[model samples]
Target: MRTLHWFRNDLRLQDNPALLAACQQGEVLPVFILDTDEPVRSALGGASRAWLHQSLTALDASLNNNLVMLKGSAQTLIPDLCARYQIEAVTWNRGYEPWTIQRDSGLKAALKANGLSVTSYNGALLFEPWDTVKKDGYPYRVYTPFYKHCMANLATRTPGVLNTARIQMVPHGEQAGLESLALRPKVAWDEAMLMDWTPGEQGAQGRLQHFLATGMGDYREGRDFPAKRSVSGLSAHLHFGEISPHQILASVRAESPADDNQTHFIKELVWREFSYNLLYHFPTLQEKNLQAKFDHFPWETDETFLKAWQTGQTGYPIVDAGMRELRQTGSMHNRVRMIVASFLIKNLKLHWHHGERWFWDCLVDADLASNSASWQWCAGSGADAAPYFRIFNPITQGQRFDPDGAYTRRYVPELKRMPSKYLYEPWACPVEISRAAGVVIGKDYPAPIVEVKASREAALAAFSEMKRRAES
Candidate 1:
């Protein structure tokens, strides 16, 4: 019996339901098809492209270098491979994104019509997006009830074990090797990401173990502080399906009782689930406002401001630091992600999609659901979104989270010499103090792009006007 396992988001061998099911039947041939044709399936951002190349390389190495890689639309490539390999059954993990769900559904129908068996399993998320819903059977718009429903309803399953010794490897037949994908950036822009991240199952497992050993202790208190280095940093791994959320949950449960810190970490995972729910319910989330009133809210676009924000020259230390960290490491602290996102959407009053697009291109952990939902949350145009008036004041956010300036200084080297007192609000320092710090505002460090108080008020007024117009 020959079975084909199609690898999509779920990249790892162990604990992968689809892969394990395929292995159970007979000889397992693992195949990965790069689908980039559909309109909803946009081109991979530069950072994600780079990470994918490394991840695929690592995955092939793990598969004893027998993993078959193909390029083109999965609709054509999948049937072609099945015919070429004389495969009888095909199995794969489900991708919950709207585009993926549609694509996979059509492929499964086509494959089954040809007398080949097709099976799809939940490999990425703890529960399928369609499984959880409100009492009336409508999808959840708010996260609280959705998370509570999931917790009470969804039972945790033990991670699956893979017996690689019993597995038979199919020979790679006319497959495009990892290098043929050209996922790496043409220019040398990823030196720091290369140093900071390891992209496969080994790297993912190592990161999880290290976080459990060291960072988990202070995760609750220090997670909000960018300088603490207490975050699990498992986001990219999660996004790439190098590791499953179940594995992380099981590891935490096995380590100790669910303490406050452990519970908080679990909440964060649930947040990811909530984002998927939003994406599943709202297919046009990435392109339009979830809250329809935001459609009428006037948003100004300044290319100069957008460029400054993108390049980490926003003149606000914390915002710049977060952006620079994103540029350097292909990741940013969660707290800083919120702060910078708020600065962009509220302070600049540009559309949230602009910020969403930039993060999609930059962050290694960028997922269609999470990125879109998060930007909407920050902009107050999402389901269960923050109130539009709750604009984040970057300086206060910095002083609160990045106090002692360690995180800011580490990323924004220009502010390395400033005093801790004047770290966040560098413009407030005396001329003599600025001179002593060897930094001149508006020259070495640019002044604030927009005044915080004024921007907040302007954002509030705009939101109010939009609300009024909607009511009328």
Candidate 2:
């Protein structure tokens, strides 16, 4: 019997249950569909597209150049390929995003109706959304209880190791290759991202090894500081299925099972699972506010402020640094992500979706579930979100997180010579100090776009008004 292995988010060959299962049955035809036109899932943004191009290239090479690449909707293409190749079964790993789950369900039903066996395995997440639930069968909404439950019942089952020796590849049908998909950007602005990442399984493994050796020891103390080399930087790799969460967890458990840092890393992995769970239970997560009261919250939609925020010209060092880093590297530190998000939603009084959309376009690790959930968390519009009145002070956030001006200096070069006292708030510098630093507040670097004290007060007043309106 011939089987077709459909690769979606689970892009790698190792530790992939569906790919492994397909290989075991009979001759396996490995295929990937570039569903650029799918209405259910939004089109891949430029950074994601660039990463996809590289990832697909690496995947094809790993398959001995036999991976069949096709472009179109998976619904019609899978059946057409089966008909053409006389495929006996179709197998793939599952996806948790609302549209993908719906698409997979319809495809499974259609294939089964035609007498073709369909198998969907969990390859992306450590546990499927439905695996862990409350006694009444509903999913947990709060992170603390949800994480505790997951930790208590955490399975030690490691990801399956693929037997490459037994693998056999089927000849390509309706031949195409990675370049045919046109995933790369037409104008070419990815030099920094190219320097920063290697988008494949090998790169993911290398990142894990480096983190364990150097970064994991101080992950707890240093993760909040953007200048420190404390983060895993494996987000894009994880998002593209280059690395499995189980593999990451197992690696940590083996090296430092008793260490607090290792435990914290595991909690972060569990957080990823938690976001997927939220999206699974609340299918409208990306489209609507999870907290209904937030539906009445007023949002100022100003393009000028939005553009300034996007371009890293917000006149706030920490905010600008994070935005500039995102544009150049296609990723940003976790702590910076929160600070910048707070500035956008609360300080500027913009809707969370605007920032969410911008990140969706700019971030290489822009996951639908995490991006939406985090934005809502900042906007106080999510389940278990931070309160709306808890506005972040951009100046202090920079001072606290990027102390000594190292992070701000690296990304916002104009502030390279500014003193630590005025690094985050250059407008506070006296004329002599600004001159000595070879920087002018309004000329060389922008003054603070919105004053921190006044903006915080305005944001609180707006929040109060939103509550009043919602109650009325």
Candidate 1 global lDDT: 0.89
Model 2: worst 10 consecutive residues (lDDT sum)? 36-45
Residue pairs that clash (backbone atoms under 3 angstroms), model 1: none
- Model 1 Cα displacement at 107 (Å)? 0.9
**Cα lDDT for residue 382, candidate 2:** 89
Can you write out model 2's per-residue Cα lDDT over 266-285, one digit (the tens) per residue? Answer: 88998888889999999888
Q: All candidates' TM-scores?
A: 0.98, 0.98
Q: List, residue by residue over 1-472, the lDDT tens digit for candidate 1.
A: 7899999888898899999998899898899888866564455688988888889989988888889887788899889888988989999998877778888899999999999999999888987888888888899999899989988975677999899778787665565788777788888687668688899888999999999999999999989998999999999999989999999989987885578898889989999999998899888888889989888897888888898899999889999999999989999999999999999988998888889889999889889999999999989999999998888899999999988899999999988999999999899999998988889999999998999999889988888888888888
Q: lDDT of all predictions, in order shown?
A: 0.89, 0.87
Alpha carbon lDDT at 316, candidate 2: 96
